[model samples]
Structure formats: structure tokens, C-alpha cells
Target chain A: MSKKNALQTVPCESCPLRKLDTLREFDEDELAFVKTFKHGELTIGPGAPIVMEESNSPHLYTVLQGLAFRYKTLPDGRRQILNYAMPGDLVGLQSSVFDAMNHGVEALTDMLLCVFPRDRLWSLYTKRPSLAFDVTWLAAREEQLLDEHLLTVGRRTALERVAFVIWHLYRRGRSVGLVTANKIVLPLTQQHLADTLGLSLVHTNKTLKKLRATGCIAWADRVLEIRDQDKLLEIAQMEDTEEARRPFI
Target chain B: MSKKNALQTVPCESCPLRKLDTLREFDEDELAFVKTFKHGELTIGPGAPIVMEESNSPHLYTVLQGLAFRYKTLPDGRRQILNYAMPGDLVGLQSSVFDAMNHGVEALTDMLLCVFPRDRLWSLYTKRPSLAFDVTWLAAREEQLLDEHLLTVGRRTALERVAFVIWHLYRRGRSVGLVTANKIVLPLTQQHLADTLGLSLVHTNKTLKKLRATGCIAWADRVLEIRDQDKLLEIAQMEDTEEARRPFI
Candidate 1:
């Protein structure tokens, strides 16, 4: 990981993500405090650990660019990817609040992150409940995502689990402008899909091939193109998330 | 369903759960605000719906007594239980923060809930950052629980999942004074376990029977007795949660 103070680079006042129509707007007071709350920027290459399991970091992070994922490993080295992180998604919140990271985070792509000191996180709550609420809001959103993930893993058929993940990722990507012309750079290996879907690598491979045979989705060279969104959603047996302006830290 | 003004029964000033060693102590001012935030008391019998899936409720709730579980159903009626709500757990947090209950909450036993009108939720944030932080803390803790739940469902084998759930519940129940003499009255049916472990009823029965053959646990008539906690943990391959004074709303 490499880091330098991000003060000179795009200030929080002009942060591009804040301009997105999908995010709730922050008032000047909230924006000003957030600007000060930011410690600096850190950039890391793909496949680097952003946070370690059961450790503490001095900072909290918001993904300003690129994709990352949070995961936990078993004693035997089996891993389960909890969810992915993207721009506007705050990482290390468990560390910021409790000073411990219960799970590990790793970048899926070269990433830019806005960092905030954990020491002052309390002050943000005390001074601006609105922003504090945003923090809670973000946490609640993460919990909701996990609920969806649990459902897919626990109850869905293997094929349904694969379909739900792709559809879910597509919706998340499109909301963040990462999708273009029905395609997005997935940046995931079949092994990652296996970890995410709770399936064996061989099972994931066969399932993906079966889904591909239907021609609803095309995955090649890390690019996933949705050939038929309706068909994909139908097989996933899920609805797209409600289109609402979401809060972020 | 039943409703009565909790003000006349047990005010937030004397909330029993707040006095437990497992919960953090609140300042006088925070306690005072919580007293007003308490709208009333709600009581329901077993098999009651505390909150509905995809619906909105006017109030947020804290489980003051009894056990409840949150769940979501697939389009075909298959249910996946997300987690259980116990004492000090804010039940309607999704509703409290966003005015939406994305999952259904149901009582597994007679339940007592401390009500907080959702409309005043923001005012609490504005008035007390400490309390706001507590709310966020609770949300983060919930997220952590879900992460663990996801891991068990996604990675563990059938017998391992059953053992983990039992061990996990024992620890949670023990911490909250619900366990006695290595046993707790687990108000769960076999079907609930089936839903929770993502296994079929026949599979759940067989797995429980297999675990039982090891002489580590006994289940009869809604009561689960742990004959060997250490052996169960060994099979589950999970460490107990770090005993800490958790915050709550």
C-alpha cells in the first residue's frame, strides 16, 4: 500500500461521487466536516490486502475508485467473500467503530481510497448526527446486502445462486456507472465466484457453463455482458433493488 | 398482540437490560432521552409477526424479553432466517433508520419489545451523538453477526453447520443469562433449523441424529442440552465471540 495526504487532490467539496444522482446530497456543514474528517488518500494495486482479519487499522476508508471485496477464511483455508466494495462504499467501519477488523478486505482492481482517522470518528457523531446517521445508514445497507447474500447461499439452487450474484453485481455496477452497454468488467476469477457462491470450483464451472449455454450472460476475458437481463432476473428469482438515493460516508 | 404504556410499567431509566454487564452504561442525559424515546410496550405471543417483509412500521423496537428471528422468503415460499433478535437487540433498526423493514421478524416465544417511534429517531441523533454512535455500533454488530452467519451457511458441511448453529446459540444465550447448567430451552422446531441451516428437513434430521450419535448434544421437546461444549466447538471449528460490553439503542 502507498499513501500521501490527499489534501491537494479533488477536495471533498468537489468529490465526483457526491455529484452522482444516486447518492443523497450533503449539506455544507456535513460536507465541511467530512472534508476535515478525511485523513488522506491511499492507493493500492489489485489483489493487495486492504485490511487484515481480526486486526485494527488507524483509519477508515471509502472507495473512491475501483473494486474491492471483504472476506473471511476458515481454519482450513476455505474462504467466503461477504460482499464487494465500490466507490461510495465505506470500508473498515468495523475497525473505525470497534478498532478491529473481523474480516479481511482486498482490492479487485487498482484502487483509490479516502482515509479517515478512527480517533475522530466519535467527534463526527457528536457534532453531526446527520453524518453519524449516514454512517449507520451505510452499515444498515451492508447488513441488507449480507441478507441477500445469505439467502442465495442458503436457499437457492447452485444455478440460481450463480444467476443472483451476476444480476446483483450488474445492478450494483449500473447504479455506480460501472456498467456500459449491458457489460461490465467483472474482474473476478471462477475461483472467486466459487468463494462468493459457496460452491466448489468444479461446481461453479459447470453451473457457469450451463448458464452460458442459455446465452443470457456472456463472461469472457473478465468482461461480463448481460445478453438478456430479463432472463437473468427470471432465473435468479429476484427483483432489482429499489431505485432510491442512498446515503454514504 | 397487546399494547400498554411501558412508562407505567418499566421506564427506560430502569431498563433491566441496560443494567446487564453485557451492555455499556448510559449517561444520565442519554438515559433521560431514551426514556422519552420509549413510546410504549408491545407484547405478543409465540408465532407472532413483529415486523413484515417489505413493509414499513411506525416504530422501531428493542427486544426486552423473549426470542425472535428475522427472515426472508424466496419467490416460491422457501424461507431463509437471517438471524435471531435477543435482549438489547434493536429489532426494527432497518425501519428505524430507513422506515422500511426489508425482512420479516417473528417471535419464537412470548416477546416483549420496547417501542421507539421512528419519527423521532433523527432527533436522537441530533441531540446525542453518543446515542447516535450507539445506534451505529448496534448496526455494525448486526453486520458482523450476519457475516458469521453467511460463513457458516456458505462454507460449512451439513453436520458442521448444525454444530456451529448450536454452539453459536449456546454462546449467545449464555452471555444473556438464558443458559443454565449447560442447557437452554431452545424454542426452535426442527423446521426452523432446516430453514436456518439451509438444509432439508430430512437432511437436518439426519445431521442432528449424526451429531447426537457423538454424544455431544441432546435435543428433546424444544430444549437443547449441550453435553460437551468443547467437543461441539471442536467440530464447529469456531471460536466464541470476544466477550465485550456491546452498545445498543
Candidate 2:
């Protein structure tokens, strides 16, 4: 059964995010205001680019469903994956405010995003300051995540790096209601993993083999199955970050 | 003459940032509101830790003068320098709103900061959404810088990484009125460079030697003299990012 077929456009009045345990609840007036802000929804398939570097975009998005990752390509053509944008994450926020994007975002799965005109962000700020704070909060949260990822890539050993990225993704996926118990069906391939971890494909494979040797994880096909979550966290030398109640539009 | 001695407290009514071309101007009312928000000033010497990880601090700061770097330390005590904070940049913003900081910031030189109570941020948001937008603008800018830094560390070659970081710091310093002609007096040492670039001290030294041999740059007694800025940019495969008029407080 294809899960994509199960998706439907839910009205903003009864947005599914309001029912999620991980997200904050908006008051009736706030909810009504946000409904008017929604211009429409966008659906893109896997491997599709959403925001390209230096391209002035007219709109920003909130991930309604599925996963995506932000990356930047060097002039010489080397690419580095910055971070993932799961459901409930705001996309192209920096560009919407600062200017054109310096990076790009690509969908990892069939993704749905709530669209908003970039120019109207000012009215949201003026009329709804609390919502504006949530926007800033989201930006700060992204900065915090990028800071942690930099630490992982620059300082962690290869074994630890692979473990860290997996654990990090699993935790983030769980927060956005994308996980099912110990399993996560991620859309990334080994090449994507190599680009993200700053390791060669062969080295990334070898590191994954080492993790498999520990009998704590199993990766076959697209599903990542964690047999022992605590052991994985132990190897990663970190705990899952606690997600506070955050607003989504 | 020490520039440190020339630094004196300037009232918000006639702040010098309005005169600088790189920073945005504030209207009279906005300036008056910011004046009331100012708690006091803090002075710290080089090598002092300002915002420590996990420390609950009641105040956030705007860099009135000098430079600082944000970093994270691994459990084994390895450190990764995230990015540098220059004059007019807000420090501890993530902590002030989101929670305790996940990273630490340290002074690279004698530093002065304008402090504001964290609790008053809400009032600022409610009363002055334009200023609030400016605050979010700063956070978004920081995120953009960190994203670029992550790409450099994770994807760029060792030589390119060295060129990129130096060029980036030079451009940022020039924007905040901290540079003179083609020279930037950085307060960081080569060890700091090693930590930031994810290289050993010896490798960082070797990389510096390579850059120095190219006749594009000179580093001695803590000052970086760019003999050929264009050459450095070419090697890094990046242009110096132009700063838009940005808010100070």
C-alpha cells in the first residue's frame, strides 16, 4: 500500500499539527488568522529541489508532510548536506527574511508544504507578535541544530559520526511524528550519507558495517531498525534533544 | 594609541551605529525604547568565557566592541569553533529565548557588551514588532553564517577551508568597522584556527605556510594583512558576502 495515496489536504481550521503531542496549540483566533495566511499547498516528489541557491523565491513553506534536507554545493561541485527538514519544520526562512538563499533544499520523499507569500511576514509580525516570536524561535532552533551538526562532523570519529547522525535523525523524525517505534523509513541512500558525514562512500560503508557488527542496528533497504536504542545513543555520546512545544503555520 | 582607551560609553540617544554605513538606522522612538531595555554594560578581557553551555543566564548582550567566537566541546574535550561574533552582533540570543545555551562564547580580545534582561524580550516583541523582526533578522543571519561554516568544514578541502575561514572573518570584520585598510587584527591564535578548521595544530600551521607562500596573505603578531584579497577569494571559491544594513540592538 502506498502511503502517498493516503494523504489528503486538511483545512487549516482543523490542521493536524494541532493534534500532535510534540507541537503547541494555537488559540481559536490565532488559528483563524493563520488559515487566511495560507495561500495553498505544494506537493513535490522525491529528489526534487525546493529552494535553489541565489534564487529569489516568492514564498516560504512549512513542511506539511515527509522529509527534506538542505545542502550547499561548492563551485568545484562538492555538496554538503546541512540539515534535514522534517514535518513541521519551516523551509526557506532565511531567504524569506534576509534575501535570496545561499543554500538549497531538496525533498527526500513525496512532500507536502503549506505555502505563504514572503511579503506578508511583516503583517504577521505587526498584528501577531506572539506568532512572530514563534518564527524567531524556529530560526534559533535551526541554528542550534546546525551548531550540533558542525560539532558532529568536525570532531567525531567515523564510527561515532555515523552513530550520531542516525541517532540525531531518529530523534528528530520522532518529534515530527515520522517514526514508528524503533523503525524509520528514511529516503537517504549511502551516497547521501557520505555527502553528509564528510566521508567517502567506501569509508561510510565500512563505518556502517562496524555499527552492524555491534548487533545493535540493522539497515536493509530504506528502513533503519534500531534493536537497542540506548546503545546507539551511548556510542553517539549524546542524548536525544528534548523538543519544546513549538508553533507551526 | 590603544583603541581600547578611545572606547567610551555612548548614550543610545546619539549612538554611533547610526553613523556607520553597514548598520541600520533606528528612529527616535525605537531608540528611546531600546534605551529603556538596556540593563547596563559588561567588560571582559581576552580568553574569558561569556556564555557557557548549560548555564542559565538572565541577560543577553549586544557586542558594543571587540570580537568573540562561539564553540562546542566534546565529551573527550575536543572543541569545534562554530563561528565568530563581532561588534553589533547579539550574543546569547538562543539561550535568552529558547533555553540554556548549547554552545559557549569567549572573548578573543578586550570586549564590551550592552546587556539586556531576557524577560524584557517579550515586551519588545509586543510593543515593537519592527524591532522584533530585526531581532529575528539577526538570528536568521547567524544561522546563515553557521550553515556556510558547516559546509566549509564538511566539504571544502583543507586549503580551501583555511582560505574560506580567513576570508569570511575578514569580510565580517570589515562590515562591523573593526578593520583598517586591508588589515584585520584578529585576536585568535593558530590553535584557535586548528580547532575551527578541524585540523591538527601542525596541519593548520602547514596550511598557513601554503597560504603565506602564495603571497596573498601575511599573518604575524596577530594581524592578518591581505596582500591580494582577490587571490584569496579565488582560492576559496567564494566571494566576500556583502553586508546589508543590519540592526545593532
- Highest TM-score against the true fold, candidate: 1
**Per-residue alpha-carbon lDDT of model 1 for A3-110, expressed as tens digits?**
445343868888879877899899989888887788888889999999999888888999889999999999999999999998899999988777688899999999
Q: Give per-residue CA lDDT, model 2, range B1-249, as digits (tens).
A: 133323436777665556678888888788889987887778999999998977877889988788899999988899999999888889999887777898999998998888788999999999989899999999999998988888888998889889998999888888877789789898788899989988888999999999999999998998998899899999998986688878778
Interface quality of candidate 2 as DockQ:
0.79
TM-score of chain A for the candidates in order shown: 0.96, 0.94
TM-score of chain B of each: 0.95, 0.94
- lDDT values, one for every candidate: 0.88, 0.86
Tell me how far the alpha carbon of residue B124 in candidate 2 is from the true structure, in angstroms, after superposition: 0.8
Candidate 1, residues B1-249: lDDT per residue as tens digits? 125452447777777797678888888898888877788888899999999998999989988899999999998999999999989898888877776778999999998898888889999989988888888888998898899889999999999999999987888888788888888989998899989989999999999999999999998987889998788988998876655788876
> What is the TM-score of candidate 1?
0.97
Per residue, candidate 2 scores C-alpha lDDT tens digits across A57-111 of 8889999888899999898889899999988889988888877898899999998
Q: In model 2, what are the clashing residue pairs, if there are any?
A: none
